[model samples]
Target chain A: MLALDIKHLNKKYEHFQLKDVSFQLEKGYIMGFIGANGAGKTTTIKSILNLIHKDSGEIYILGKEMLEHELELKQEIGSAFGDINFYTRNKIKTLTNVIKKFYRNWNDDAYYNYLKRFNLNENKKIAELSTGMKVKYSLAIALSHGAKLLILDEPTSGLDPVARDNLLDIFQELVEDGEISILFSTHITTDLEKCADYITFIDNGQIINSSEKEEFIDTYRLVNGKEEQMDSIKDQLIAYKKNSFGFTGLIHTKDFDPSWDIKSALPNLEEIMIYFSKKENLHV
Target chain B: MYNLLMKELKLGVNPFFYIMPFLTGALMLIPSWLYFLVLLYFCFLTIPNMFAGYKTQNDLIFTSMLPVTKKDIVKAKVSVIVILELMHILIAMIYGMISVRLYPNLIYLFFKPSFGFWGLCFVMIAIFNLIFISMYYKTAYKYGAATVVSITATILFAGCAEWLGIQNSFVSNLFKGAGTEHLTTHLFILIAGIMIFAIFTIIAYRIAIKRFEKVEI
Candidate 1:
């Protein structure tokens, strides 16, 4: 079943405009959204959630149009942001009760189970909780609500190393249920590398590229060579960064000669991000 | 609707907002002569506090993301305003009864306070709520200008009432001969005042819901 489909969504502001931004994610698969801070990641997500008005185009979640089926569409989906998404005056118990009123499928047992696991006290006011605790509570709430699709924007942000790892584990577990899918956005590429099966890279309000994770990682290779070797390779390169020591470029792994000692060292998503960023800089 | 209303109450009913009504209502202990003064004071000061809790938390964007509809959000906020207004009226009326008991034959200096006066307070609050909700929902995401507009509209309502009282035509006729002897006219005035309060409150709800439906977050 289709989880989300954003088609030609358009919105404009004074300094920036989202022009025909579109992508899709299927059920039971995690799609990692990668972008720069001002690259319109939040804008696109806001449009889908209907938090911001869009100039044109259509969005469908679980095969229902957002405008007509707003309440129904929202009921099936859960969302969280990098910042804790609740009022500070609320105690966790009050927050849970409020959420339970809106979600028909709210599972109190699951909520309590998550709180126990996360070491969250139900009576603690949100303002008094630590940042990490707040995020933990937010995720716990999201997971407990029987949400078929989880739309998280930078959920791992501001979390310590241990918390980040624990969250990644929860994400994997959530997907393991096969009924849940995550559309996770993050600058922490390492997190996505571990759990994402698909990726869609956005740049300056446009989708620059998208593909399955295995094929995406396999399609590009870091080619280290001198000027002589570089002269022989230009069109075969998709992205590159160079220094006086030598030039390094990303080439389709299939194009490299088999006779060379070209080891297939797994490139970190950061390396891939730098390549894309530099490529955009070159255009400017 | 209850979900949305509860969310607003949770966020809107902090120490500052919850206590503000009691504190302001206590001012009614001054004199029956100053009752309109107290009510007018309340209509301006209390309504702005509705958005104060929202300011402290910076919660508008976060609140909009939940499954609650935008219309429900506006309704919840207006409900809080009404709640605070009622809290003010109830407490002030209790103080009013105390003043009457302490001085049974005292003639009010400005206009004798009565049930009619308390009912008029509700009308005052309801009108301000209508203007504030209708105006605020249009440009609510805009923090500065929307607040200024709403607050300005609130103050203007008080100004218009003051202008009416200068001649004692509209407000005075309602309280005519309300001094030494109690009158059922005060009862009619109270009932008419309540009807006006209900009508304007309904108008505010209608306008707020329509505006909220089109609000972009």
Candidate 2:
């Protein structure tokens, strides 16, 4: 079953427009949503959750229309935004009590267990927690409510390397049961490389690519050669950067050739994103 | 709906603000302008500060993440505003009773804290409610323009009512002088004020729901 399905989702602001964006996430797998800043990653997530109204689109969560079954779907879907938008002055315990009442499946034991695992004190005020700790707190609340799907935006941006690894491990453990899925959105591509089963790349409010992570990585190759050969291959490159010693560019694997006499390697997710994001002026 | 209401009472209601009623209610002990200040407390201080708390805490964005509907959010917030207004008036009414007993024949510059005046206060708050809730919910975080506009209307109501009470002999005789001798007349006015309050607040709630439904977090 698909956990989330969004089709032709469009939203317009005075300065920015999300045009004809669409994607779907299969159940029991993590889909990494990759984009540069202002790439409509958050906009797409908000539309799926119905936090923002879409200008025109159909959104389905758990096989039901989102707007028609918002309360029902939201009860089963857990989400953590980039900002700690909850009451900052209140204690975590108070927030828990207030939030837990809305979900019938809320488990106290699970909540306390998560707090212990995260080394968080329920008595501590939300204001006192560091940004990484706040994300952990949000994750704890989300997990304790028997949520079948998690939507996270920039969840690892504030964490240290060890903490980010720990979070990825937790995500891995949750999906191991084949009952949970996650749509993880972030600019941190290395983290996605470790746990993402699928990847969707959005650029300038439009999706540029969406596929299995391995398939996506296989589609492109990183090519580096002597600087003098830059102009000959520039037309075929998605994006490229040059230095005094050499020039590097991203090319489709089908376009690569040994006859070019250039070194080639499988590009990482970060390289892919950076190359895709590079403007035409940067190619020189 | 009840859970949303409880969340407002639990998270949105500040302890200091909770106690502000008793502090402001004590102002009724003043000799002449007891009623106006008590009413002004709700307009000038309570509503603005409470909304500021919501803004600082980012309540609207956080609550939108919950399982409740936008209708429930509007219902919960309007209910809170009414509840706080009632609490303030009820507390001040107690102080009003004591002030009347403390000085049996004290001259009232504004309307006395009688049943009729309480009815006027209710209508006053209702006007504040209709304007404030309607305007504030349009954007959901903007309370400044709403508060200013509503308070201006409130001041106009209070000012007109007081001017009529002090300057017009028939009005003075009706509300504060011989008017107290007839129970049914004031009772009818009180009932009319309450009806207006109920109608205006309900209208405000409906308007608020419509405006808030369109707000995008």
lDDT of 2 by residue, A100-219 (tens): 999999999999999999999999999999877888898899889988999999999878898889888888888998889999999999999999999999988888788899998999
Q: What's model 1's lDDT at A7?
A: 93
Off by over 4 Å in 2: A280-284
- RMSD (CA, Å), candidate 2 to true, equals 1.7
Tell the DockQ for candidate 1: 0.51
Can you write out model 1's per-residue Cα lDDT over A1-284, one digit (the tens) per residue? 87989899999999998988888888888999988888888888889899888999999998889988888877788888776455776788877776677877788899999999989999999888776677778778777777888888888888888888888888888788688888988878888888898888887888876778877777678877665566667566767666786678876668866565433454666777777777778778
Residue pairs that clash (backbone atoms under 3 angstroms), model 1: none
Model 1 bad stretches (over 4 Å) = A128-130, A227-239, A251-267, B15-19, B40-45, B104-109, B141-184
Interface RMSD values for the candidates, listed in order? 2.3, 1.0
Predictions in order: lDDT: 0.74, 0.88
DockQ of each: 0.51, 0.84
Query: Candidate 1's error at A257, in angstroms?
Result: 9.0
Tell me the deviation in Å of residue B146 in model 1.
4.9
